[model samples]
Target chain A: MLSPKRTKYRKAHKGRIHGLSTSGTTLNFGQFGLNALQPERITARQIEAARRAITRHMKRQGRLWIRIFPDVPVSVKAAETRMGSGKGSPEFWVARVHPGRIIFEIDGVSDTIAHEAFALAAAKLPINVKVVARQGEGA
Target chain B: MANAIKLAATARDRAGKGVARETRRQGRIPCVIYGAGQAPVMISVDAAAVARDVHASNFVTKTYDIDVGGVSHHVLPRDVQFHPVSDRAIHIDFLRIDAASLINVSVPFEFKNAETSPGLKRGGALNIVHHEIEVRCRPDQIPAHITIDLAGLEINASVHLSGVSFPEGVVPHVSEKDFTIATIATPSALRGKEDGEGDGAASPAEAAKA
Candidate 1:
């Protein structure tokens, strides 16, 4: 099994299954929706709101967690190298937005709870919990 | 059998590495459409448009309504070519899927549940052994993904290829008992506890009996 860290590293330095550049991009292929996730509609306020909601949800859910919201200085390099990726932000400009499109990554949980959490988020926010890519040992 | 996506395409009169590079420079991707008992034909497509659709999960099976030299054809992705350096699609292979023909394709796995699983809650990590599995099905009955609800799976439990249920008229080519698709074990800090406890109890019991 591939760890999320190894997977990201493989995607960055080695190559990715989607065949897209990892120079700055995270996901290259797989099922994703752009229905309302167009780049133009994102706003700083909405990102902040989503960040707060997700962070609170993670804390309330009772687990060690990390958050990566849009315009939070989350570089592909940082994601490929660092475990937490980066930090939170409230004043960064909105890089992109779609009403319900988001990337939610949860670790150290069961499939059932993960799914439920994903469903809950999807229902509450304009985002989709596409898939989970876990890391290997020490990842 | 749900929504079938269609896109316009064109057959290329010129073929070769140079032609392909030129096509890319013009914001087009080189592609090929074969199968249906016909010879392989080279083609090109709008790079941006295909990229958006390719980002979707079931890229290959989705019917692309392509127009090649004003001729319309329904196609599915078969193979992809990427730039060695850029990793962007340089060439694509689309097969003209026949309604009656059974084709082999790899479908994605969508795992559900994370926040509520006992294993995950206890710090056990979920590791997907297979991201996609190959199955035989008609073009129209192609499933977008092989969704598995990981609602109550314990740590070390797996969802194998045999466990995957397909849509009507779809069947996995893998024989019974074949160990295919799966989400298996990735021991972490949590597993250490189990290992410690298991060894401690077993060793003490064996020593006392001796």
Candidate 2:
């Protein structure tokens, strides 16, 4: 799973995602992209799972880019623990994704392969996604 | 010069978010034609017609003859705003142009002879640095697209702006440096093989395991 090596604070506050993403909305590096259709907090494990699915479907033939990173540390309280003991230790990392963000990009693959790869990857994600090709390129 | 595509549109009296939304609800795309010292004209074109054109190749470079309420306007597509989620055309901006007008337009590159490139044959990736190059030319002289030949390129070889040939009277907008347009880059799998043989440093995965 992807996580930060170090951080300024051990635990961070959970933030809210609002509105559509203003950046990372366009396909900058690849010919095909998987676009987010709703806002959600995606865990590092989920990201890794999606990446594995995409790479496995592509047979590692084309290049892939994960546009979003799991930077937010999510902490949890232990089971059956009655009261608050300050804050629970950081358990995992998550990425707050906004609507219209391009979560994954792929290149050097045929349109059919790219679409299939994205479809396999989308099953691992929590939000709805659509496969998009770069404008003026293959549809 | 390529023949201008003809599109019919209706003039609209109002312009705003509400009006634009209303226009979209009626299956029309809100558009504006401005430039050449003339007042801007607010119009609405058929949603399907404009969407087809926008999705086509070299949309901005294509010239259009827009007939607004029986008045003809020669224009070039300047910008398109798409709905974030639906990816629908929400708004469009068109620039009025004429024969004498010299405009700077971004022309896409059409790479040719990729199969003949020695670099591509060796499992190298054609990493495009610039998909399009901005050029200054008369509206009528704007080439549909610039061609970049990749016939004899080898791994790590680069094609720069200086090496490209443009049509008569069309010149690259940037005159400062010979910027790279594309390169035959080594694939990551090939890079890994070279690195393992050349260096003793532990890979990221190996380091993580440790």
Note the chain A TM-score of all models in turn.
0.36, 0.95
* CAPRI band for model 1: incorrect
> What is the C-alpha lDDT profile of model 2 across B36-138, one tens digit per residue?
9999999999998877778655888989999998899999999988777888888999999998979998888999999999998887778888888889999
Model 1 per-residue lDDT at B167 = 77
Can you tell me which runs of candidate 2 are displaced by over 4 Å? A4-9, A83-85, A137-139, B194-210
- At residue B171, candidate 2 shows an lDDT of 91
Cα-based TM-score, every candidate: 0.55, 0.90
Candidate 1 residue-wise lDDT, B1-210, digit = tens:
555565666778888889888889999999888888888888888898877555455676577777777777778888776443334677888888777888898777667776666765664555555666778988888877777777777777777766767778888765556574544344434333555422211222233454
- Indicate the worst ten consecutive residues by lDDT in candidate 1 chain A: A1-10
Candidate number achieving the greatest DockQ relative to the actual structure: 2
Interface RMSD of 1: 16.3
The DockQ of predicted model 1 stands at: 0.03
Model 2 chain B scores worst on lDDT over the 10 consecutive residues at B197-206
Candidate 1 per-residue C-alpha lDDT over A26-57 given as tens digits, one digit per residue, 9 for 90 to 100: 32221221122222323344433433443344
